[model samples]
Target: MKPLSTIVQAITGCLLIISCNHTPRARTVQVQSSANESVKDYPSHPKTAEELRQELAETEAADPAGMLLISGTMQENKILIQKPDLFHHSKYATDGYMISGIIRNKASIAPFKDAIVRVTFYTETRTELDHKDYPVYKYVLAQQVTPFELKVYPPESTKDFNMEVVSATAIRN
Candidate 1:
């Protein structure tokens, strides 16, 4: 008996003569990207000063709280409040550890004046993702300058938790 390779070669030779014009196609695979929490890759969307102000106005009406939700597009660097200096350790079980950060609004947009910020955290639960088992933290505008919201998670003993910020509508009207 002939080898399997020889048989396959004969079959290919037949096809090659039949379709002499058509070239052999290449085989490849493309896999989709998996979701990773820590890997935060934000796309760049350039916005003019005027456009930023307009978006700030629209977002103002949309949410009563002036929370600058980090999004893929639209908002500029000013809209985001990232505390790189602060550490976020998810894998570790941090009990009685106080994790805090500030929720602030962009100053470039004047319409968002006095945008009061609100903060909340969710605990890692068995049945749900962000369970409100943790304490509900709140903040109201008390002064001229923006300050960080500092408080302990779970109020007593913090397990794995996530942070959230809600900025009240800056519009005084």
Candidate 2:
């Protein structure tokens, strides 16, 4: 008979395998059936040329940092770890859910390599979840440019949890 800790380890490993699966399998997912049907009934209204330009200007003024372009599949893959690589994870109880992904800058730029990409996943309310509440929290570290996969972690429930990612600006100090 296997020990309790060993059985837990095996189960966690299985969860990791399952969560890392990116293949489009022939499975049925029950999408929300009550989506607002009126969305289709609404009359078509196209934005005029000037109106669209003004909207774009407004958006740019609001968000100066260009949005990160992440395709759906790429987004999923970006959450996986390498099939095999060195991984180190530890919980840091801070004001909120904070994550630091160290990446060596490959560009010719000098001081960029000394900088790191810091991502903090704070709750919508800006509250940080405790380490114990989240049984499975994966920390994925990959190259920002050509990230094939992210750090894979075991599957765990994260219902109603929302997270945002923001890369910190390089601190010259």
Candidate that scores best on TM-score: 1
Q: 30-120, model 2: which lDDT tens digit per residue?
A: 8765765544455378779877666654543332123222211202223223353367554332222222222332222212111122222
Give the local distance difference test score of model 2. 0.34
lDDT of 1 by residue, 24-69 (tens): 8897899666776456657587888877768865655566343443
Each model's lDDT: 0.43, 0.34
Q: What's the TM-score of each model vs. the native? A: 0.30, 0.18
lDDT, candidate 2, at 37? 55
Name the candidate that leads on lDDT: 1
What would the TM-score be for candidate 1 when compared with the true structure?
Answer: 0.30
Q: In candidate 2, which residue pairs clash?
A: 80-150, 80-151, 81-150, 81-151, 81-152, 140-151
- Scanning candidate 2 in windows of ten residues, the lowest lDDT window is 108-117
